[model samples]
Target: MSKRATIHRMVTPDHLCPWGVKAKDLLRRSGYRVDDRHLKTKEANEAYKRENGVDETPQIFIEGRHVGGYDALREHLGKGPDPKEGKTYQPIVAVFAVTGAMAVTTMLSTSTSATIADGWAWIRVGELCVAFSMCVLGILKLQNLQSYANGFVQYDLVARHWVPYAYVYAFVEAGGGVLMIADIATLVVAPVVLVISAIGAVSIVRAAYIERRDLNCACVGGGSDVPLGFVSLSENLIMIAMAVWMLGKGSV
Candidate 1:
């Protein structure tokens, strides 16, 4: 018999609670038979919270013992807290994974005879992935632009001296990505992208390698705990490579 657990989480038309989803997934992964309860309305959800004397939803119960919220459930299951001090690659990995899929799908949609055998197709995929990754990353940063600017200035040599640069960097990156994707103004966009990416690469090298300082990367987002190192450096280098390729190819 499996360990039985019950979870009451919010699920309304407009809002599906992410923590609730995470809690349920975690329970399933931990070998628990979960009785997932949905509080389908705002009023009902509030009432349940009030009756249970809990401040939030996604409350868990195991063997009739209250396990509290998601964090509490993690503790109850003997899983320690997520490492805040330690670096993580999960966010960056997820970003690239989505970008890669999008790149391939884009190729397929644009070309009737799209195949991996075509070297140009592969090059286009590479370019698309790099551009899309930049756009995605920029969007992430722009979600909390002020926070991103603060975090970015810590290591970016240009941002350190010119604080305003950090704030506008996301726009620049995303705009470049858009231009590259549209194959518009390649002569203008490619050189600009190359310069920014090269500067970013240099900044990462100076901060991570030369200084030997441990810092969180603002490449994905300001709130992310991703480390400042190879992954971040590679993001810039890949963008640089794409920009150089575009410049050489003279647009499409």
Candidate 2:
């Protein structure tokens, strides 16, 4: 006979506990027949928690032996909780990969007709990559401007002082990216991005390096969980470099 597992989870009209669902799925996949018990109301949930002497919901019992919550259940089943489930660089990696591919394609397509030196052509590709990446990131931020503002204020110096800067910042990035893509308005767009990115780089240095405070970066967007550190700093630095490169080329 298969072992029986019981899960006491909260399922209100407004919310269905996600961990509860995950636990049930895990138990079933592990060959255990689960008795899914829903605490439908807040009072019922509180009462069940009192009875079980537990502060949280989604309590699990395996074969009438108390096994605790989701994390405990995973440990009991000999599978540790996935380390990469929460904090991940997958989103940033995807953005970079797509932009890089676009840059390479654009470069290859124009390589034969290129009037510039080979080295300058490669630099142009790098500019395209940065511009595209910035556009994508800016779009993500603008999708949830309020959310991004909330996250941005945590570490951004300009955002902390002037709340509206976060929203403007998104537009600036997108605008600069668009101009860069068309290879137009380098005199204006390059300097604008350079100043913003320089300010951002300094802010990052102060927050992540000097202060040593751990926080989520709003680089990718408000919902992203990418850590506020080297990756974010590098992003700002790349923008700075691209802006400088464009300005230098324009001068020649």
Candidate 3:
């Protein structure tokens, strides 16, 4: 028999894709080089069937024998070699591991960027929020702080103004910053930060409460925040656990 025959393996980047890898390794053992350059797209798979007569991964041929699918390949190679143990949902396990890892990484990266190292860093980060806060605080700043009354709360609080409240927050933030760097009160701030992140993530589910349409985004490369959407919920579950894990370790 001529050894010129080839095996064509079609594989998507799915959990069983690793099974494709295993198939290739076995192919090499069986004296055939498997080609898989065009394996992921629907067009490619359809094209393969049009060109050849098969439409599946690990499509095998032994010296032009047309041995067929994975089971055929198994028989040609001989039995009693090894038995694959019953592994439940191997593909799902792989997918979950990958997706969970990615979401947690994203959340950690975002939280780290929003945080400032000390009072100095806090002042700098707060300055960036000034524009947004000021827009909320606008012309009202010109009037006396007492001039504005909250009809709902019925309490006269500090009138919202960009420059005025921005400065106010900046000054108070200095203390939180110092506390973080000094590690004097990390426990208190850590819980509050987690709570804030949770609220921020959940509030997006309600359209009326949406102040800004997108995330601050400078901290995360994806330029999106983890809201309460399905993807966002998954991200937050991982992140919330990470926060708890760090808290348990007491590392802040």
Candidate 4:
């Protein structure tokens, strides 16, 4: 008898989250028995994150070993590929984060589909998800920047541009996230869609430069290893375009 391997995946309330489902399905197909532990709330999930320092959900562990998230698991199985790091490149921790985030954005931009009865539930829930994600990410980013402030602040970069830029981003994101709760507020969503997409574009560029030799992705607020290449670039670019098109049409 073949010894069945047991795989444990941490599943927070993000079951409806595309990435979570993808992780679950992929693990099942790999022939490992999946044990899912669902958390009660984001606070509970954060408690887990504190121990693991991994902010995202659907973490797959194989036989008690920390295999990784969806992308890492896929790579381990040789089914999906995230290439090895180049000589000068740091290890990448996000082989699938870019694509995953793109999928998330797609769901978030679907305001038209959200107008239907059941669809409203999905949209409203998705809005909450976005709001939660944004707030968590923004707070973490601000904290990270705080340490780096002295380096740039000495030159007045923060005073002249960084502070204003951050505020503009915060206002748009926080306000648009609130407005995104309903379809009638599509007007607010438009600018927000553009802003996030633009921010993604800049990040893609910066990512390329910062990781010229390839490196682990710190995009999702943790250390995840994934290959860096066209896949990453394409994902970000596609997401930017999607945001642009979605905002322009006032629907998806």
Candidate 5:
């Protein structure tokens, strides 16, 4: 026979405790025959809490032994706490994935044969990938411009010196990306992107690698919690490389 679990959850008229629902679901999924007890009133809930000597609801008991709350129950079930409970790379992943897809689509559309053998074709694909990634990142930053600007001052050299630059940085990146995609104004955009990205790269390296400051990266936007590290540096380097490549090609 499976072990029995009792979950005491609070469900008032106006409120249904989310943690309680999670506890009940976890217990059921863990092969426990759950006896779900709903405390539907404040008095009843308080009485239960007082009786159990626990300050919170959504208390769990497995085989008549107290298993505490959701986190405690997870431990009791032999599963450790989630490592990535707070931090996430979802925004960065989304940006890169979309950029890669767009690059591939552009390559396929422009290619003459099944395989992309032309060197120039590959360069165009690379440019598209970098440009698209920049556009996406810029759009994310522009979504919450104030937050992005606040975060930017922490590491960006220009933004630290000139506050207005932080506000305009996202627009610059997006504009450059659009021009790159359209294959227009390479003489202007490439040099501008190259200089800005080089400065950003230097700033990131100083803050993250040299100074060893543990901070959040604003690369994916101010809303993201991505760490300030190699990934951010890599982003700037990619833009620099793209700009250099475009400039070199334009000269030829």
Candidate 6:
């Protein structure tokens, strides 16, 4: 016989508990027959919780044993802990990996003579990758400006002094990225990037080194759980390097 599970979840005309939906889906996928119970009103849900002595909904029972909420259900099923509950660098790594592949493909497609063996061509590819990454990350932040600003202000020195700076950071990264990719107005662009990235580097150093605080990096997006430390510091330092490289190459 297939295993059997029972779940109590909150469901109302205007709202549905997300965890409840997930728990039901998980049970079905794990080959269990589910007895779904929905509490249709806020008062009903609260009363149920109070009666059961549980703080949250989506409570599960399998074979007469209580399995708790979503996270607990996952643990009981041997699916490991929920990834969203912990830090992850997957977003940033994915952005860089995809953009890097795009840069190589673009360079090869545009020029028959372009090869990885060509030193200057490889340098150009690297620059394109960085510019593309910046633009993509900027778009992510812009998609949820308020969330980005909330996280950014926690660690950014400039944002700490003036809250509006958090709102403007996305535009600066995207604008500079566009200018960098276009290879126009290098004389102006290089200095601006240099200054901004230098300031960012210092801010990261103070927060991660001097003060020793663990923080979420707003570089990818505010929703991301990537830690603010080496990777975040590397981003600013790389921007500084790009600025210096452009200036030294006399791209103006």
RMSD of 3: 16.9
Ten residues in a row with the worst lDDT in model 6?
A: 109-118
The lDDT leader among the candidates is 2
Candidate 1 stretches greater than 4 Å from native: 1-86, 114-116
Error of 3 at 86 (Å): 4.4
Error of 3 at 126 (Å): 57
Q: What is every candidate's alpha-carbon RMSD to the true fold?
A: 5.5, 4.0, 16.9, 13.9, 2.9, 2.9
Itemize residue pairs with steric clashes in candidate 5: none
Overall lDDT per candidate, in order of appearance: 0.90, 0.91, 0.42, 0.50, 0.87, 0.88
What TM-score does each of the candidates earn? 0.71, 0.77, 0.28, 0.34, 0.83, 0.83
Error of 2 at 197 (Å): 1.2
Model 3 TM-score (2 dp): 0.28
Candidate scoring better on TM-score of 4 and 6: 6
* 27-119: candidate 6 lDDT, tens digit per residue: 999999999999999999999999999999989999889989999999999999766666888888898899899889988887667465689
Candidate 1 C-alpha lDDT tens digits along 1-252: 999999999999989998899899999999999999999999999999999799998999987789999989988889987455567899999999999999999998877674656898878898899889889998998899988988899999899999998877889899989888889999998998898889899999999999988999999878778999999999899989988999988954
Error of 5 at 205 (Å): 1.7
Error (Å) of candidate 3 at residue 137 is 54
Per-residue accuracy of model 4 over 1-252 as CA lDDT, tens digit each: 321333334445554555657777777776767776665566766776778788676677777778777677788788766444443223212323432454356555764553544655454454445444444434433455543232222222222355555444444544554454344466556566566546544554554555464443333222323343444455345435534544665755
Off by over 4 Å in 4: 1-136, 142-163, 206-218, 221-242, 245-252
TM-score of 6: 0.83
The residue ranges of model 6 lying beyond 4 angstroms of the native Cα positions read 113-119, 143-169, 221-224
Residue pairs that clash (backbone atoms under 3 angstroms), model 2: none
